[model samples]
Target chain A: MSGRGPSNYMHIGHLVIFEFVKWLQDELDAEVYIPLSDDEKYVFGKVKSLKQAYVYAIDNALDLIALGFKKGKTFFFVSTRLSEIYELSVTLSRYLTFNTVRATFGLEGEGVNSGVVFYAAVQAAHILLPTAKKGLLVLVPIAMDQDPYMRLTRDIALKAGFRKPAAIYSKYISGLTREPMSASKPETSVFLIDNEEEVRKKIWSAFTGGRPTIEEQRKLGGNPDICVVYEWLKVFVFKDLKNMNEHAYKCRSGELLCGECKRMLADALIKRLAKHKARKRQALRVIDHFFLHEVEIPSEIIKILE
Target chain B: MSGRGPSNYMHIGHLVIFEFVKWLQDELDAEVYIPLSDDEKYVFGKVKSLKQAYVYAIDNALDLIALGFKKGKTFFFVSTRLSEIYELSVTLSRYLTFNTVRATFGLEGEGVNSGVVFYAAVQAAHILLPTAKKGLLVLVPIAMDQDPYMRLTRDIALKAGFRKPAAIYSKYISGLTREPMSASKPETSVFLIDNEEEVRKKIWSAFTGGRPTIEEQRKLGGNPDICVVYEWLKVFVFKDLKNMNEHAYKCRSGELLCGECKRMLADALIKRLAKHKARKRQALRVIDHFFLHEVEIPSEIIKILE
Candidate 1:
């Protein structure tokens, strides 16, 4: 399972994460549970308003659906869109304490809002929801920085009588610049929503591992280890990268230049994003099918909505 | 608007509050919104579990319904019984800060849970909900200790662009033992659901402001000023208190003894409770009509509960 805040459009960092999720889904035919935490983003100030976050969730969901996951097996739940997740989050919040959430999220002495503190439980509820509903143990794909949330969820799940979900922790996908490719810096990451020209511009202006001049680069060779475009190519574009280490070797031998590599990645990314953009348009019409609403709200609770 | 964390059965204190609510409704033809904070009770450890809190909310609601609140104007919403409140709470929580909540609640270093902190927002949402839906500012009746909640809600409502609610504050209703009548000391409270025998037992053994000996009392007169029975009689039982100073005068003149007062109060209470219990039984069947379901949940959210 993999999901995001959905307050911002899906970027290159998010694209790689979903690619990994799709890869796992293909290999195991496992059910995918994607929770768009619009509440978290809105409350945490990632988005200006909940309505915007919710709108972005649908927009980002279209992008995810475009990735070609099996529709029948994939379930998407937006935080504010679904009431059960809030209900489940409240249930999970009981077993978690303020100090635990604060200390776990390294929020001690910080002046974060109540929603920020409660967001940990919402995230935990997302992880354990499959276990609660389907009795299926979830295998979440997250980055190493999110270990605390995983650990916190595992601990709370044990106390709450839900199965602890297994997780695959990977490193942060470095940005095109020195900083991480995150919502904080829009220029560092290429968004799926970006047009071909925008994608090409972001890729062309991206940071790379190269010498000052072509003569020095030919003498000392270019360093592919630190090249953002090469890294993106290895992680997402070229699926068979184990054998494609030759690309890196060619760079080291000065057979490949930074401009030449940027063009190659930009072409491949433009092609992929073009196809994704087309599918995203088609996916928009069927967005309703992806949000499963099989929530077992108590009959008494049903009266609240009457 | 009046509500309590429904983790316990309604007692004498609660009865008085609701009586005040009924008085306002009768006088002004006001619409009453009673939200049983089951989530608050469970999260704050007032109840053993959310399920138990919810059950108690429904049961307490029956006692409230029996009090003869107008079915059409009276609205009953249990915290766990509703989804919109949670959504509304999240919306209100955005403008509130943890420091403000902690300082307002004086929960600085305490080990309160995340839900406990977020409950302030939940309560604010409850107060602002009427305004949010019908643009009717709420007039909440609360004791002095709950002023903080009202103040917090008013501040948040202003920030959230909702009209601030007005409040009428009263002092703590003294308990039978000089302590406040609350859930903590069951012996001090006469529950609406208490049987005739229990009512008689509790009222008879209650504290009173009488002299040590009957002879001393006869010579000096009893002090009705500090008497619990007199307080209950003056506050709830006898509505015409301006003329009922004669009863206190009788106690002061030693004409009315503690036994006579207890017997009068107990008999009156037992009769009132008996009527309430009878209506409570009838209330069970018609409770559904009181819970209005005209919640304007967005179509997007409707898919979440599908």
Candidate 2:
């Protein structure tokens, strides 16, 4: 249940996931431990210095706290402080052989770095951290591409005598180019810090299949199914069944145009994520308190305990 | 400078190397950090349980403390508590490729375990942990067979951007059968707990190159160079150079017989190692103190801090 630091502005991908985690805490009676995975950012991210990584991790942690996660329900910690987890990682690595890891990852010849290979074991150890033995069902919601790592983790868990984790696979949110949205490519995705104008311009320039001429549109019909902007609406907004169905059918019939669809989806997305952004601002200001202090064990959790 | 647990009695091989470490500390002004590597013992050694390893590590730590390591000057800690070092080990491993490690250690396919490969990085990390910014000149005194690991560690240090370690290699002391003495082979090695009578009996049963008759030995000289008992005297006893050279030539010239040579070497070895055995006895009683505290940066260390 750990999150990475928001070194770059919090993008739509992060917002969607954190919101889902928050929903799980409120409805599913889950006791969540959110680790700010600053260590990963330090090693993988573009931050050239350790000091920069620390600052970036702190900034990202603030953004996460602002996303309205209840202090009592969530336990937030930085990865650097948890040395016990690293020791456990070494123990886990010792039990797994190199051939087994290579087969699991599909790595061939010299393509894999030792860091990437051992990183799978480190991730597996994270799931079995002492805090994870709370007897609650563990659920990890990550992008579909990251499934290989989670699958490897499940295999390692069986050997280590720990329970396997259940996962929720979410599809990637695409960018203006209709390619997978990456935080590194800021222009393609809307960040939490993006203002109203930037959000509008990105949507306006977004790749769509609709034509300008009425004859061409009628002949071809706008393929709303292939449009990245339309998919964004389905994932982020227009959750109502009747409204979504009507929009999809109308767009396919050439009754609705690309410009109209883009503007409507943009408006809905901004409205849907606005509350989270405001909270993110507040979270950043008081981050020191949230990260350093232990929160109360919620009454609901205690009742389940009793 | 991590020490092994003392609950299991140390053999002569352990004594020889430990004595060398003591000499280095006295003459080289070395600041020794002894990690009671109980975690390693639990994972790899005969101890099947963590509880056993914990107890054993404590016992051994006390034994090492009694060997005259200054309390403030020499720091001792358990491997489990020193998570920072383990984390650094993981980081160091990333910089080292498998090819480089395999080449350095002369490991072939299936020849190396993941732990064995990772341990070299851990050993390198151990040498660098005390000083992060500045380099250090580490000296490791071990048996000749262990030279490969030290050599690998030195190469890893160069690649990992740390200080190189210098090694002082000592040859193994052979058993009564003229084979390398091993703790696993108890009859061949005299433990610290061995009584005087047992020591005398073992020496008496020891193999020698002595002839059947003194008359035959006077004409045909004993092979002092090939004799295990004679070599023990040259390596472990007879500190005075003049007397040792005189005895070596005399033995070769048929001046000293094998029976007399065994008694003299055994007496010198027993007398020389007497203090270590006494200290080991006192160590076993107070082994509890070694595991009582955590490793902290001492004031003196901080004064010359990285």
Candidate number with greatest lDDT: 1
Tell me the tens digit of each residue's lDDT in model 2 across A1-306.
Answer: 645553454677676777788788788867666665544554443444334555555555655677777766666655545655555665666566556666666766533334445555666666556334454556877667767767877776777677787778776677877877877887788876677888888889888878778787777778877788788877777768887788888888888888898898789767755776666556654555665333333233223212
How is the predicted docking of candidate 2 categorized under the CAPRI scheme? incorrect
The local lDDT score (0 to 100) that residue A7 gets in candidate 2 is 46
lDDT of 2 by residue, B6-119 (tens): 225466656666667777788877777666554455444355544455555554554466667654556666655565665566556656666666666676663343554555
lDDT of 1 by residue, B23-60 (tens): 99999999999988877877877777766776677778
Relative to the unseen true structure, what is the C-alpha lDDT of residue B23 in candidate 1, on a scale of 0 to 100?
A: 94
A-chain TM-score, model 1: 0.91
Best by DockQ: 1
Ten-residue stretch with the least lDDT total in model 1 chain A: A296-305
The C-alpha stretches of model 1 lying farther than 4 A from their native spots are A108-110, A209-222, A249-260, A292-306, B108-110, B209-221, B249-257, B292-306
lDDT, residue A15, candidate 1: 71
Task: Show pairs that collide, candidate 1.
Answer: A293-B306, A306-B293
